[model samples]
Target: MKKRNLIGIVLLLVLLLGILPISSLALDEPALNSKKILLIDTASERTLIDRMADARAEPASLTKIMTALVVLDAVDRGTVSLDQNITASAAVLSDMVEDGSTSNIVPGETMSIR
Candidate 1:
């Protein structure tokens, strides 16, 4: 009877230990606190989460997307080739340095579009 009770206690302890860690590892949904937030599935074109998505708000840092789109369109139209080499201008380098952008490039250095 003593051995049976000991074995049962050991088994219960092991089961709780295993289940507790797994339960704790479960991810909680993120709490987004912003004026407007939009989460979309790019592949499916599905709006997963939309919080005032349609409301016109000042585009801050969103201009990068527009710039990228323009560049991509230009590339597609054969206006800009991917293999084209670009030399870093002094003004551009100065701006990058002032903006504290990280890069291995130096002023006057030439780099090819990848």
Candidate 2:
């Protein structure tokens, strides 16, 4: 399997097994670092743990993972290549937050998509 796919599976497993189990075990206890978190069983479509599920918060690193997944999907479909060099344009840099996490690329720096 591809490395990206393996990484995605590993992340999902860590969420479903490592995090989800501990999150739902305590309702009276209030201890969490995430602004928004939710775990829903895909087979049954049941929500297991929901914390601030309706709140709108900046995604931070989650967006990186999501972008990787989308790009990997495109690569699998032959729509995008891992060797392609992507240059960050001004419009892309315009979305950056001063104190928040964003891609480590500058507006002009170019690097392989991989």
Candidate 3:
């Protein structure tokens, strides 16, 4: 009877240990240390958290988001297909090379949409 009670106690402790961290995580909010941050709920159009959200900063790679949206919209409208081939133009290749960007594709090389 005591051995069974000991095993039960151990199992109960293990269960509590596993659950405590997860419950703590659900209760706690993470610390954000960024100049600008925005968290929104798309469903309700609610802003959950915003820190310096209005401040405009230099957008270096953020332009990629617009590019992706446009590409996805085109794909959705059947204007571009995934299997369609795109050839790298000489101007594009030269520009990329001059900018010290690395690419697997050579000039005039054809690649699939993906």
Candidate 4:
């Protein structure tokens, strides 16, 4: 079996073992982070607790949220047309063309953000 499949099965089994939805658990307790944590009640559209949430070093995972927000905002404002092409700037390429992290975009490549 592929490593990904094995990991997925393990995660699925773990999920199945838990009855309560993950989102509910967050409202019941504060995450033990001496660093940073933010809890939001999605159903109520409110923040339950926040602690140094924005003070951390920017992790690569957080970039996806920023990218999603930017894309959503652009879409909502119609600033970025669906047919428009965006060239990967050299700066963006240099930042992404690293071993550990990347957007997997090469320099000079044109991407349709739509």
Candidate 3 lDDT, 1-88, residue by residue in tens: 9999999999999998887766666756778787898899999999999888999775556656776788788899999987788888
Query: Model 4 Cα displacement at 29 (Å)?
Result: 4.9
Per-residue lDDT tens digits for candidate 4, residues 1-114, read 699999999999988869777786675653484567788999998988778878845577777888878888898898887678899888865665355566666678888876
**Model 1 residue 81 lDDT score:** 82
Candidate 3: count of backbone clashes, pairs at least 3 residues apart or interchain: 0
Tell me the tens digit of each residue's lDDT in model 2 across 10-114.
999888786566667876856778767898999999998898899978776778889999999999999989999888797878876687664476788888998
Off by over 4 Å in 3: 3-33, 81-114
Question: Least accurate stretch of 10 residues (summed lDDT) in model 2?
Answer: 96-105
TM-score of each: 0.41, 0.53, 0.46, 0.46
lDDT of each: 0.79, 0.83, 0.79, 0.77
Which candidate ranks first by TM-score, i.e. highest? 2
lDDT of 4 at 33: 47
> What lDDT would candidate 3 get against the real structure?
0.79
Give the Cα error of residue 94 in candidate 2, in Å. Answer: 0.5
Which run of 10 residues does model 3 get worst, by summed lDDT? 96-105
Please give the TM-score that candidate 2 achieves against the real structure: 0.53
